[model samples]
Target: MMKINQHILDFAKVFIAINLCLVIYSFAFESMHWLLNTQVAFFSSLFITIASFLSYKRNIQSRISNLDMSKTSKTEDRDKIDEIDDPYDLYTEYEEIPEEELTPEKIKEIINDEKSKVRKDSFKNTLFSAGGFLSIYRVLGYGSLLFGFFALNNNGIFLPIAFMIGLGVVPLGVLASKLLFKKL
Candidate 1:
């Protein structure tokens, strides 16, 4: 699990490196020349912003895959526990025992334990999904905002268009997230 997490961290670092390079390239070359026309600047910024968002999505997917691998191991451990000899097993020697054989408190404890596990798992899954959504939103939001600023400073014509498109990112992202959540 640690190894998987380390690999995910490394992957994230690589993404950061690539994003940095893109940022430098945009500022040094593309931003300077592409800002001549409002339409061109708006479109260019939109394209780059989408590309950055896709890159972030890929990074998140890699991390999720790693997490899923770790979760599989945990499920295996649970399966092992289920297989172990226990009085609760239907095929065990204690199968003939009456319902009253187990104390009421013990039965309640078992039920509570199962309920807790379910609640914990649900919480974890919800948190993971929410975190992923927020991360994507942040990446898209900031990228679009920055691109809009560059477009506005370079070409007056594209300023309104760029800003409008940039503002649209949040709603688009929210819609996409909702669709994704529904599909999941």
Candidate 2:
């Protein structure tokens, strides 16, 4: 469950990155005459970078708080349901001792049982998501690349420059996200 939420969060990160690129592209090239300079472009890029970083940080903190809450509740429930008092209640009441006393064979069996216990929290996340989010960036990049070629063919100036901005803006956005959120 934790891993699934993380992947969903990653998708959100990529989604924000792609949108930031689009915003920067439009602001630098498709804006008014006063905003036609590269200064406005860089400013917009910086604004988008900081904004996305704040949002991603907020999201990660929220998820971690929720996970902590769930963890505490589970431990509380386990303690309340255990119908044991003191002394012999050393282990949980759910455990079944195999032998009468703690003989060498019994100790071995206990160790083996512990080793084979099913720990849901110990599972590892796979090195993939439901779908790769990079494909969206690729499509965005290719579309801008094509537009760039067309803009170069015509007497256009902003479109070609905007295409270059769009090409590299996703990486910049991603780097900002990582730097601020401290995650990939």
Candidate 3:
């Protein structure tokens, strides 16, 4: 994880530098058409922002801790009191295997435990991002706005459409998402 983080940080520096150059060139030259314009960047940024926000929420979520079998005894002297009165198996248990009996097959359980933790935490976050994004709407919205307003010179028609979909859709989508997930 640390290695990947270091590699991404190194790549991000170059990526930011190129974007800076592109911004400067777009403004400095009149005839030079910027391949990626402000509208495109705005839509991209919006999608990225939404994804990052969801990821941030996922990162802070804590999973149920698994038991370390070595510390606990195999024998149950008596039934423990259930204060919560819930029958759900929250923390998973592992049968304590003798250290000398630890083979290649037993090691898979340890690997699977870690993998399960990661997958469980990220499941909802992954589902949210899979369908929700601005790019799909932006390509359909931004291109039409720029063409209908700028090319055809109809500010009156374009402004309302742009503002409603551009500014309004995010909140509406978020509300819809919350309702769908029962998070509201």
Predicted candidate 3, C-alpha RMSD: 15.8
Per-residue lDDT value at 14 in model 1? 43
lDDT digits (tens) for residues 15-111 of candidate 1: 4444445446557765543333333434444455545566667667865676644433434334555555432334433235467767888789878
lDDT of 2 by residue, 58-172 (tens): 5556546655444334354456445244222345447566566779987899788876654423331111221222234434444544554554446444544644554445566
| Model 2 CA deviation exceeding 4 Å by range | 1-144, 151-159
Indicate the worst ten consecutive residues by lDDT in candidate 2. 124-133
Candidate 2 has a TM-score of: 0.28
Expressed as tens digits, the lDDT of each residue in 88-167 for candidate 3 is 43343557888998888778988899999899859966755443443445355545545533642342233333333333
lDDT of each: 0.52, 0.49, 0.46
Clashes of 2: 0
Q: How high is the lDDT of residue 84 in model 1?
A: 58
lDDT of 3 at 158: 30
Q: What is the TM-score of each candidate against the true structure?
A: 0.30, 0.28, 0.27
Highest lDDT, which number? 1
Best by TM-score: 1
lDDT of 1 at 170: 37
Look at candidate 3 and tell me the lDDT of residue 132: 42
| Candidate 3 residue runs with Cα over 4 Å from true position | 1-8, 31-36, 39-50, 53-184
